[model samples]
Target: MENEKDGELLSYSVTLNSQVVEESKELIKSTGGKLSPILNNLLKKWVEMNKVNSENKE
Candidate 1:
């Protein structure tokens, strides 16, 4: 499937800490933010950081 502008999409189920999830929901609601974008940005940053670390290690 395709995303609005990010091209293809993949679905994965992840387990997160309950407390953190609750806190994140509250923060998102208070700030009028959407969860998907927040998660996407976080995962993208994590992937980039890991890639850089792996390259440096090689």
Candidate 2:
């Protein structure tokens, strides 16, 4: 994000382990920029699985 009014550039750095990242570059090349929805779906599945696990413990 950039602060256009102040002419300042804002950015955030996310640190990730390469081996765990699954090299999405290849997927991007194949899908041609449709990765956002796929990522959202995966995150939804992760949250559901976490909820299921917590429920089982109780």
Candidate 3:
């Protein structure tokens, strides 16, 4: 699938705690969502928030 923010798709690996992984899996299944896009959106929101905060401090 194409990414909305940037028209590119990339894949990588990371490690997480077993409990968090299990909960994330259940949440994804219940919400009918995929992990990659969900993580992408979350990271994007985090970056945006940090940028806004940084700008406000200046």
User: Taking the tens digit of each residue's C-alpha lDDT, what string does model 2 give over 1-58?
Assistant: 3466333321111122222233444454566656698785674455556555544534
Stretches > 4 Å off in candidate 3: 1-35
Ordering by lDDT: 3, 1, 2
Clashes per model (N, Cα, C within 3 A): 0, 0, 0
- lDDT (C-alpha, whole model) for all candidates: 0.47, 0.45, 0.48
RMSD of each: 13.5, 14.2, 14.4
> Residue by residue across 1-58, what tens digits does model 3's lDDT show?
3464232211111122333445555665676655578675674455556555544544
TM-score, cand. 1: 0.40
- Give per-model TM-scores: 0.40, 0.39, 0.39
Candidate 1 residue runs with Cα over 4 Å from true position: 1-35
Model 2 spans with C-alpha error above 4 angstroms: 1-35
